[model samples]
Target chain A: MPVSTLTDPTLKDAHYLVDTGFEHGEMLTIVGKCEVDYDGRASSHLAPGERLVILKPDGTLLVHRNKQRKPVNWQPPGSTHSARLDDNRLIVESVRSSPHEELEITFQTVVQVSRLEVDDVSDLELEGSEEDLRQRILADPDILETGFNAMATERETSAGPIDIYGQDADGTPIAVELKRRRVGPDAVSQLNRYVEALERNRPSKSVRGILVAPSVTERAKQLLTSEGLEFVSLTPEQEDISQPIGFSEDADK
Target chain B: MPVSTLTDPTLKDAHYLVDTGFEHGEMLTIVGKCEVDYDGRASSHLAPGERLVILKPDGTLLVHRNKQRKPVNWQPPGSTHSARLDDNRLIVESVRSSPHEELEITFQTVVQVSRLEVDDVSDLELEGSEEDLRQRILADPDILETGFNAMATERETSAGPIDIYGQDADGTPIAVELKRRRVGPDAVSQLNRYVEALERNRPSKSVRGILVAPSVTERAKQLLTSEGLEFVSLTPEQEDISQPIGFSEDADK
Candidate 1:
């Protein structure tokens, strides 16, 4: 809730009492150029340079460069840390005892240091899953077409989880394979396996396999058609997948 | 960027130009609940409800429910798209021909729509890579210690890329392995292999292997100690790793 900027670079024996209740407790933000040395599985080092160091509330230690999506190097949570300013430098040490790993960051020149306290649960959280998407299709078959009606979701097969099990207007058993990406060869193979298994188990009717995705690959199409399967494109609406189940509060106007 | 809101429940025959000139082009922000059908990897459908669909310039389409970082279901880029308002609904379609993938987003009810345009490059860019970190270490021997000096980086052998190859203070041959996560059993095993290979090839001198990462797993530590290795911890200053290279201008002041 409160933030303080460390004007004086040197600090020692400082204590911060962030809430213990918070899972990811406090974050220490520091900007400076310094030497980086990591001692854990293997010993390594980095030359002194200008960089930003963020000590996460959870014991995860992250080092970032100006560019990239992933931290240059990181230590997962469940570690203890201590920072001390001595001999005109800031020395911060973090240790994880289970693996017996340690991190030492020496700041040759400290520009700024601040402690961040998480105040509220304003962060977004979505409880979205593959099953949620399947349930949606089972609720409405018109999305696929006027004739398509999903009989079941998560149909168990020897092959794997069949997203949808349904029948066409003509009463042919349909096995649907669902994925987020364009249909690929692997999906086609999987659908074929399920269809073959179903057909062998129930010879009275022929089972049709349909590969469903937002898109389909040329390879997938060839594979699907050659294997006697169908393709359907479904675009999911842009919505938060994290909202609680049956919670449609955002667009409730 | 000009943004617009569609208050009308029904939309028909709408056209917008989201240029491919932008790497991640235009982001179409839509909020509402509707069915999501992806006909690609496997046919998939999501029951219509409140969610966010983001169409990126790079052809990546993302559907989100409020709290998750990853899209509930998404279609990757490298596809063509066309949007039209037919009857009282909005139809947004994306297609990839190579693998033949198509994603269709049908909005049964429209609540909001916005287009995002990126127009500036004032961002911090880091040429962040394990190689970059290794280069930094190779450039500065003092980070390792006063007596250590790095001889080479990415030293090629049957064992793979040696993060750092150098000599300790006593001129003893040292092989270094670097990783971003807690050192694991695999990393230790890898280092042991490299050391064994290096020692077998060069019999007269002793070769010391050091495993370096932000932290180490208990198993990794045990493995490293049993194999006679050293560990060091390095925490890099956090910077934006998401920025493109040559764009490091944010903290350049």
Candidate 2:
């Protein structure tokens, strides 16, 4: 059976199914009224409420409430899962080492329990990231500046890796930082660090810093000005890319 | 009905259930083979694979593959959802404005569709947050330093709000930045901004900056030393707080 479900099962029966599911490495979901406790990097307690609990074979566990996309609590992949019954309650616990986190869910009533055999082997292809922005600038350096000469990418400095190292038309050294979306003062600080590192390395020469992003916050603009840096408005994805033909917008029907 | 389930549904049947589920404001889960496309702040395309799709009542959507804690793709709350049949396939689309993002899922075969009525009103009680750390310091200022006086919290500055604004025993103006966990160079820069703002406001007095967290990265420590700032190691939750009595460690049995 690809999916096995038990509705309103007795506590003993639910425990048996959960034990078997853990042993057989099947994905399991339990809908019930439960209270949760978490301890590790942080600590939390959830009062009794009905929730959907999902346990994946790869040791991922999620507790979902009705309203939000993010799970109320979760154990990342590679945790150890166990179940037990005590004081007329069913308890499920997940624990992980190396930073050491533990999440415990105690159920008062089991509305439903399901075990599923899932088969999925697909990867997600994404665009409009920092890498895409870098490619765009590299393919057409003139887009960044009219006389910019590209030298190297991810060039290392004592502070960190400079996103792009190049020279302007005037031949002064330039350190470029890339942000895919809008930026704030943090980006300015990052660029300042790289510029300072370059100046320290070559005491007699002047270095310029430029930040490339779709936009900058007012505070970031002020910080850039105070630090003697520059900003270039650019996005990771081109604006002119058209959507796929035949993609329907009539889904409401 | 609190719950409804359909197995091996035809595309037309699935579409009908999805439409009704959306209208009734129920949480729906669909298990099927599908392809996903997202266009928004970024763009992505996922190839055909068996996945679990969850649609929450408050305009949240999640597509989960078999293995990870994070959804393969998701739409945050406040996105309008709709479904339809196209070319014998079940299509679900979610769209949101104010940045204008869209997510589309095309299902080749739907194994099951379930609508669940979840009752969750209880809020999570969490500890070990930055707020808790602030409270801790407020309760006993000496934990931060002997004779250190706390003047205000969330004190507004041109840079941002200082987590804690105070003075040292020497009566020097102090700006304290707090982090719940280990921090990197960014935290140092943030503290620097607050200190600079204070210095600009009062030109005669030298302002001091302090960072408080459980720990600091080596790079952050270097940045702190170079910028003439201070760091204090402290956790949001005290280490001596004991676990509840009778909390079982024998859960493996």
Candidate 3:
């Protein structure tokens, strides 16, 4: 196993490309998307419907399905007066410009019930198990799963054999571990070992691993790049993975 | 009854002094007072220990009575979270801030039922006789007595007696006619006349009115303002005055 770390500023363009959208002021809609590329793309390779979002504007926010010509509905991020920003022009434009990816509607549930707090796995009245979680991942046609505990093998670490894992719609396996509490060279070594073990042992499907954390040490990011493992981090508002691409039309003005 | 209108914005401002809390980005807490001039002070104001709120932050909203500083103890607005903002905050910040008024806690039911379709409230529904409406208003302390609505009497141009009525809260009132269509400058003029009559009738009380319309004209805002009758062009959100406010703490970086 090897160890490495990296920081966002050192990366080309300061951040890796996760998605693209059409931004008119605070209103943003995913006009198009590039494949989740760890490396930055050249301007010549810019796809017709793809554009970067670099700001968060104040206005209406509407979410709708693919190729829809008008925003189905709207909600103000932080105010009363629900329909304050419902402009017809913006709704039409967003629908006209929306990309092909099916809008992923995250099922949000806040559990304040003490019996079902975050760490209550044993008490969890599960419909299934860890393997069931993976099976559910595989069963999804759209395959956008989030907030599930990762499955790791007994490849071992200073803490434990418990590592992070992800499964795609077709059962492609990708493992990820967080160095959330601390950042150092050893994180790279640790993630690399997990990746190597997963690859060599050959879990039930195609396997890859990602090292995800808030901010990676420079050395770790550099070495991971050299070793070809994915590295991911947050950029302010985008930290909420479930938030859709853009602001609503009313939000723009 | 002599008829005149309130054309001065300053008087309107004074009429709406207690309502500045509902203004943009401002907060209002109804610290109940037995008496005061409205710097939020009181000669005999006693704290009722309940707080209600209306907040608008950058990307977050808060419209709940956050009592005891714990999640479970929270209640939706109007019930625990009153329409007033200060009452909501007092339940949490009472330990530090001095009491300014004796706040009251009135309850209203707020249920979450989506896709509310706004249709016209029929003229029949909108057309209860003046006596019936006055009786209905007086019967519900939760209505007029909660300081949401205040009634004023004045002379009308076409109709002899007019009721100058404010909205549910301490907002601008309307020159309501039990049966009227094609609300014109006369309806406008009559509303102004009532405002004057009401002021003369009750020299101590502030007077305002809305001329209820099946549809208000494009020039209605200007016409109403010129005549000194504050009218509300009811939006769908305003119409759903009973909707409960919900709170969710989203983790943002």
Clash count for each candidate, listed in order shown: 85, 0, 45
Which candidate wins on DockQ?
2
Query: What class would a CAPRI assessor give candidate 2's docking?
Result: medium
The TM-score of predicted model 2 comes to 0.93
Give the per-residue lDDT digits (tens) of candidate 1, residues A22-57. Answer: 234555555555666776644567666655455665
Off by over 4 Å in 2: A241-253, B241-253
iRMSD values, candidates in order:
11.7, 1.6, 29.1
lDDT of 1 by residue, B1-253 (tens): 3333333334542233222222345545455545566765445666665555556555666655433234456666666666776666677787877667777777776554544442222232334345555665766667766788888888876445677888988999889888765656667766766786688778998899987777887756765776798887753322355857767677686
Ranking by DockQ: 2, 1, 3
lDDT of 3 by residue, A209-231 (tens): 66655577765566566557776
Q: Which candidate is the best by lDDT?
A: 2
lDDT of 2 by residue, A178-199 (tens): 9999999999999998998899
> Each model: TM-score of chain B?
0.72, 0.93, 0.29
Alpha-carbon local distance difference test for all models: 0.61, 0.91, 0.32
Q: Which ten contiguous residues of candidate 2 chain B have the minimum total lDDT?
A: B1-10
Error of 2 at A10 (Å): 2.5
